[model samples]
Target: MGTWIKETDKAIYLMDGAYYLQKIDKTAHTGQVEGETFFRTGQLKTWLNSKEPPGFFLVSVGTGVSEPQPLPPPPAPPLSQGITITKSPSQVKIYQPYQVAGTASTSLVGKTVELYIDNSSSPAAKTTINDNQQWLVQSVFIAVPKPQVRNLKVVAGDASDVATLTLTPYIEDHPGGTKLNLGGSVGSGGSNRASDVRKVQERLIALGYTFANKNYETFVQTIRLFQSIISGRTAVRGVDGRIDVNGRTQRFLEAANAPQWMLMPSRGVGFYNLEVIDQPWDKHDYGIDWMSNVIKAAGIHYELAYRKNREGIAPIAVNDVSLPQGGDTIDHAGHETGNAGDLALPRLDGDFGGITWSDRRYDRPATKAVLEALRAQPWVNKSTLYFNDPVLINQRLCSRAAGHDNHIHFEVMVPPTP
Candidate 1:
């Protein structure tokens, strides 16, 4: 026997194997018994009928049982994409091939990467990314005709990076042509052979000087002209019409044609040649591109102020940059590095020849402008300006030093070579 309940609309009963219900309780009977509910005749019914606590009878009195619905899964995360350059060259030779390497994202793998020169729309070279997301462009060629700075850019997908490369000119023989016995007068059979005079004429022509005759008189005049141009003044030193091909003339010609040598501005920024000429024989007047760029930028900035006012600005005397190879020079503790330079304070007379501490000609306004310009440069170490001027020192623009009363010593910080 089992328990049974009777109502006006339905009949709820318990049987030997299952709990059953009939449509008798028409009043829509619905209630919970032991955490299970008994609904109307056409609805689902569930009841605890066994000894097990969680056991229940689940059924639909007049309708069929329905299946349960499942929940949805969560969403996925975003993907990352970018390009990075891991290695590049800081210098390259004209018409030479070099390697450029870097990495790309997985999305870019198997895709092509492009190399550009000076932001040109047309790529100079291209390479494909490997499975490991790495890329390398080998034997990339630069076709620049002369020695200068060039910008290199690498691009993949929507990302890119840039670098600078210095292209150096390649020369076979001496920069001034073949070595010669530039001793004794050889023009018009004065003492030497005609071939020697021809070589001199050729060298002079190569140096942008016009010389047609191969006579001794014409050669002497040409040599004097070359000396005057090199000296940047009317007074040409050691010019006695003798072509000592291995002496000062040879040295001057070598320096003049040297691919690595760059002349400092003669009018905008003066060079105290006396100090440079007095250095050891192996040392010469020149600095690397790093220091020269900074000096040129600062000089332009200083001159711009006066140019804007329609006033003439005198040249600023520069001293002791570095030797051709950048090593220790006489009288300088740190100009051994190609990054240090000394600049004499400007004077009212516009002549840098006789500037001194006691000469009441110090152009304070121009000096201040130049200091400010130097501080604004990226490579110039602003804290390295050493001067003894009380006004500049008090303004925190320069530090007081004993011998810096006549000039300001400055240095540029060069990035470590890779």
Candidate 2:
């Protein structure tokens, strides 16, 4: 057929019994339009039917066909001749470099491939397809606080493909074999090898520790502070302010930036679990934040029911554990972060019915037991229970709060930031 083309808002160039549609990609071009080919006729028809612009009608070129007609379905499967991803890391750590590899058609060889991450306008990476029709984007890194899924899209000209990968917090690994050992100790009264000291300083920075300088005294004090907060050695004698090769301090630092988990409903356990409960006052139950430690502590706390001979107790209920993005919810004062949540008070007869701490139906003993278990958790801030039970407060289990008579508001310890 002679020079067959269809025109509407977007121009469709039809040649050799194939249709190519051109659309504007603002990022792909300064003032030019890019043509995208639809492999199936149905897809083109759907687009044409749905996206017909106002005051626009199709203008057919030549006498090949006056109007677009539905063609018969192909007998064979479509050929493997498009851009496809062959390699991508399922889980990637934040701030760590990774690579994504894929193959394109031989016709796309020597062309550029643009990688777009999440909803960002700019491409995270770009590379040219090689002679073998293979493309690799190297040294791709993502920076985020907690664990989350990241959407990745690669576009080579008009051909595009999408992928998803888990973007986790950066957790450094312990080097294996001889690499495990540092050159020397990295602190006061130690050899303080330059390389070893640099390594320690870098890890501390990643863990959100900041120091004025790398002076010997400042480094030592920073090490001691890290020991007190992160390494769990608060005592004067316990904190040596030194990191020996393959020592406990080194191990803690290496594992400091591990991935966090979202608070989820328990799987196998019975009533002892802290399951997600509805908040009567809130519009939506936003229990989607990073509170895995709190959930785990609830399980550990309620497991004591068997030991206390209170196995028939109702499952502990939790509410309003922050939004997925960790911001203030409606009608709340302090749940702006991910690590805090509200726990329903235990009532008489082990039911989930509402009861204030002052009410006679309030099961003080059971609530007290839960408080003790929560306090025992390593991640829990021991002195910060925001429930206003007089008896428990007098007993020093929890402190008094003005509006916390109905529920207990607790916070889990989060990593320090500079």
Candidate 3:
């Protein structure tokens, strides 16, 4: 009952019925190996040392485990990809049952895989298979009405013998036009620059997207708008492959996802709602959805960032909130200061106790809404809001953090020191 090792496959050999045994080197003596031939000890001896093939077990045992999982019939090769909902389809309308399908190739036969729908507040869409690994979502799942988008994801198992699948339903060139370009341009309008890049990263994190510490891929991964435009994926590429979306529907959706901002008052530390950027502009623009789901009825606008630090702060100017004393302030100084953003809310928008400007209650609703939205994303490590203040944000809105009166400041605080 000795064992043998195969030079090819990196599999192990077991001496006895004990399952986890490792490979034993080939011995000069001969006997029957489980994998070579089924002959008992006598017959195996005749073949050994002759040019005859080695014993079955000695040759290579097929525990049947190494066989690659049989693949589903082929429709589209299973794609091991990640997905995101830049614009979640909250409204479920009644669309007729249309077929949803995907394909993948696997070596294993008879193995099964679990198909999943991403973050579905609804149930798992109905899934079934056509003859050759072609999979589809049955009508029961399609009962969900339309005009809204759905994301699809599939994972192969028994232990991933194949790549995974990530599928998302988006408004495919709805109403407007159609084009797909993939390139980057300098000074291309829209809030598509530094701040927006950070915001997009924030949203992706909240929706459960992982990333590396290196900035290159993070930047690319964060903004789907950019990826769509630059990677030749979405319709951002105009007819002639022009790299632009100055003011398009897809851009509108992308911008809608950008973050909204607040300013630490020009008069004092208190924060205020000045203007909203709707979305972080492109790489040269401003938009929070470009960041995360954090949103206001409007979106992000913060202090224009001053130079010198405040007490626990820094220098001056028109915080993205507003211009103090109203001088004809025009130039956007290149100093991009980053502040941490916080809100103890969930991925879904928060109905924070803080009052909004329109709410007109004791709570400073506008500031409350903005701050609460920020709290929902993983990107915003820390932030200061204008809620504590009776004026900027009504106290009613703030269930915690007292109320950010002077101004809600967000600092990108890092982990602890060893």
Candidate 4:
């Protein structure tokens, strides 16, 4: 059979039934080209290209002519219009089970959808889209350590949308009376007189409710949260998100914000107790919870940080915190509230007894370490230390005092609200 190149109006052609035949390019017209065969139809069109060849074609093996067809072009990629947040609550309880639902593009089906709070790179929760192009994150919790507004962002591929939400603490508001009074109603559906609303708003701010400015939307939700958590009966009060004059909500808010004290438990986690020395009736361990937490944390830090092996070091000894009722004491000039306390300095022999700084048993390094740890607590008010250690005083750790020669005296202030 004679072999030659064949051309058609719409395309060029080559045909052979021998599957093992090496591909013959247009560059070799006179001699047999030596290479792999183009027996497979997938690579046939590429082999039949006319651009880089010596211009030769092959003849058909039999009477019927065979023509190679090009494969159809691939379909275009789908365009993304972005994801959307469809169902989300305006107010959600902090740390409680919450549901968020949204819709994404069909292209994002089976792709991961992430829910973020504010600008956080880490996702608060995630889920995959269904065949219907919708996603739902079920029973995922949103954290709100303090009262504030949050922006929830749902993202799929390069598309995202944001929804605003307010978060309220899950704690119940116990019954308490507040001396604070309002001239008129100060919440949703209330008089909302600028002065009355301002007073209530400022009080809420002091109690850790946060808002950018005075607006009814935020105000109503905060009030509703406050009302919902107020346990116990104060007559016929309801959770209406409104604070009428002399209402139970107003009373609860006042009582919640009152100056409360907590008595340090006897022999607790990080620190141990050393009860009243002589005046048992006057000396006590009653102090506010925040200050007590600072002391306890300091004790933990001192034991863990000062020595590599906490096995040998005795825990910090607490002499006094405040009276059971928080009043004047004959031994101290200023231990009225839980604001101040006396801690026996660390001893050379790791004893819990008191020792003056001048005593040979005084462990200056250990003492300084504990004091430094105490000062490092975030809630500590950085009050002046009342110990007579000249070296420590020079190191800015303590100040010399007239009567504070036996132990260290320090005070703490209440932490400010956000």
Which structure among the candidates has the greatest lDDT? 4
Using TM-score, rank the candidates from best to worst: 4, 2, 1, 3
List residue ranges in candidate 2 displaced over 4 A. 1-263, 266-290, 305-311, 415-418
Candidate 4 stretches with Cα past 4 Å from truth are: 1-259, 276-282
Predictions in order: lDDT: 0.54, 0.56, 0.30, 0.59
Candidate 2, after superposition: displacement of residue 369 in Å? 0.5
Cα lDDT tens digits for candidate 2, 293-370: 455534544443222344556555666554432333565665543456677787777764478988888887778767
Q: For candidate 1, write residues 225-253 as lDDT tens digits.
A: 44433332222334455556465555555
Question: What is the clash count of model 2?
Answer: 0
Listed in order, each prediction's TM-score against the native is 0.36, 0.37, 0.21, 0.43
lDDT accuracy of residue 349 in candidate 3: 28
In model 2, the worst 10-residue window by lDDT is 21-30
Model 3 off-target regions past 4 Å? 1-367, 382-404, 411-418
lDDT of 4 by residue, 142-260 (tens): 23454366666777765454434443334224233335668888777888888887777766666544541346776776676445434211111246878989876787567543233
lDDT of 3 at 121: 40
**TM-score of structure candidate 1:** 0.36
Listed per candidate, the RMSD to the true structure in angstroms reads: 20.1, 20.9, 23.5, 18.5
Worst 10 residues of 4 by lDDT: 228-237
- Which wins on lDDT, candidate 2 or candidate 3? 2
Candidate No. with top TM-score: 4
